[model samples]
Target chain A: MEISYRDMITVLHGMGFGVLFMLAFSGAIGVIYATTVVGPQWPRSQWDNAMFRFYLISMAALAWLATISGAYIIYPWYRAVPPAGTTDLSAYPRALLLSSPRTAGWHDIGMEWKEHIAWFTPIAMTMVAYVFIKYGPRLALHRQMRNAVLGFTAVAFFSTAVAGLFGAFLNKYAPVRGGPDIVLMQEK
Target chain B: MSAEHQPIGLPTGPGAAAILAAGIGSLALGVFSFAGDAVPAINRAFIFWQPSGALSGVTITAIVIWLVSWFGLSRRWAGRDVALGTVNVAAFVMLVVALLLTFPPFMDLLQEI
Candidate 1:
């Protein structure tokens, strides 16, 4: 079996990094809630607190990886303009989506929104991680700080959800396909 | 913090700075994106890298803004507990506004005016 390089990278960008980051939100949110809401009732040791901080840091790292890969590596290919008078627009995903009125909205709305909104996830997540790391279990003491951290994490979750959903739909309609073919298992 | 490093109960100032800077960075992204969409000249100008188009510049600029604001605010309020109520509300408001601004429909709606 053979797969195009672009398809593999695109999958890595979306399913690999993006989806992993999205999945992490549930765990991160649960731990954040526990840190702020229930941790005050039961004190955690430095080890436990450090573990929670590490989790947040890992989530933030995933978010950064997802965003950077999408924007720098995948996005350039996705938005590559078709040469003049190009009849077959298969190589250009953006033009392909825009060539037909039926699919034009995918580029105009879905992609436009996805590219921009996706960024908030990393920024918000970084802040959440930093705040949690800074305060750790003591977050419960400062209620305002605790709430803001929770709120930002929630925003990161919401941002990634929107971006990931749109990304799935966009790929379904106009997949980013190109680059050298990579061979998997072959007859030997 | 790493396992070797201890996480103390830092003052709210540091946390607030991070939160506010995130909000500002998000808002900057929304603004730059909308501006690039609405103005052809601005769009062309934002093409810092040819391959990535305006997106390269937009994101980089926003990140620079985020880091700078974070550094400035952190230095300004480190150790001291700043007024968090105002910072919290302002940050949330900025986040909400950034969300609205990034929405395509909202951008179109505002552009129509």
Candidate 2:
């Protein structure tokens, strides 16, 4: 089961879209939770609180996975060059074939920030979720913790949006070479 | 005011400040250690690993600081006085700084100036 770079990009693109959709859905749910449950001092059932916790955990996991996988696939510079003895170049796209470092374009810079900032998302989200679980029940019950959780979630949402934007730019401006166009052997 | 509504325990005050300082300091070390040609010896030592190693070092330091601070300070503090506000604000600032350091324009500017 060999997969070409083009196929990888296609699969990744689909996965990215799915992650974006999930983020949006989760963000909406978060807003609802903040406004209706947290704001109104509504008596939340155990199941309701559990569902919110689950949503937070899911969003964190999805954001972590998406950011890591996206960075790995989108940044060709991070990859190691093939061994000197091997001549196969068909597996990689031209954009990834650079022998020298290229000047950092705006998109590249955006990705740099995105990649580093994304490292905090999982930790921040997990902390918020942990606080919710430890405290238990209505957000109104724990005002300070609720504010902190809301702040962290807001940052998480921002980071996810930025990552999606960077991915879109990379896909549009730095596309992978098609399978048919890849040369099986490179000239030394 | 109920037991169930009490804040979760976390490091606070000096403990949290220490952890935050260590984390940010490690991150700064990582960024500056890899930037430019100022330290040829350090670069040569990390020739195979370079910036990745430096970055990982920062993360590792942060984790250690967090764990140590949690154990050392979390038990000492009462729930409501946890000072989570301070920790959260510091963490947020550190996150922003980390991002800014990695931003392309910042990196370019640092190189030029």
lDDT per residue (tens digit) for residues B1-113 in model 1: 33212324566778889989998998899889889888999999999989889988899999999999999999998887777778989999988998988899999999999
lDDT tens per residue, model 1, A85-176: 99998889899999999999998889999999999999998999888777777777777777888898888888898889989998898899
Model 2: how far is A115 from its true place, Å? 2.3
Worst lDDT run of 10 residues, candidate 1 chain A, spans: A35-44
Which CAPRI category fits model 1? Answer: medium
Model 1 off-target regions past 4 Å? A41-43, B1-9
CA lDDT, candidate 1, residue B47: 96
RMSD of each: 4.3, 7.3
lDDT (Cα, tens digit) per residue for candidate 2, span A1-188: 35556646645643554365345556534553564365534425767667766766676666556644544444443433455666654333232434325623533465455555555555555555555555545445545556656665666566566666665555454444445343546667
Model 2, span B56-112: residue lDDT tens: 444444445555654555455533344545665776676566556656677667768
Per-residue error at B95 for model 2, in Å? 3.0
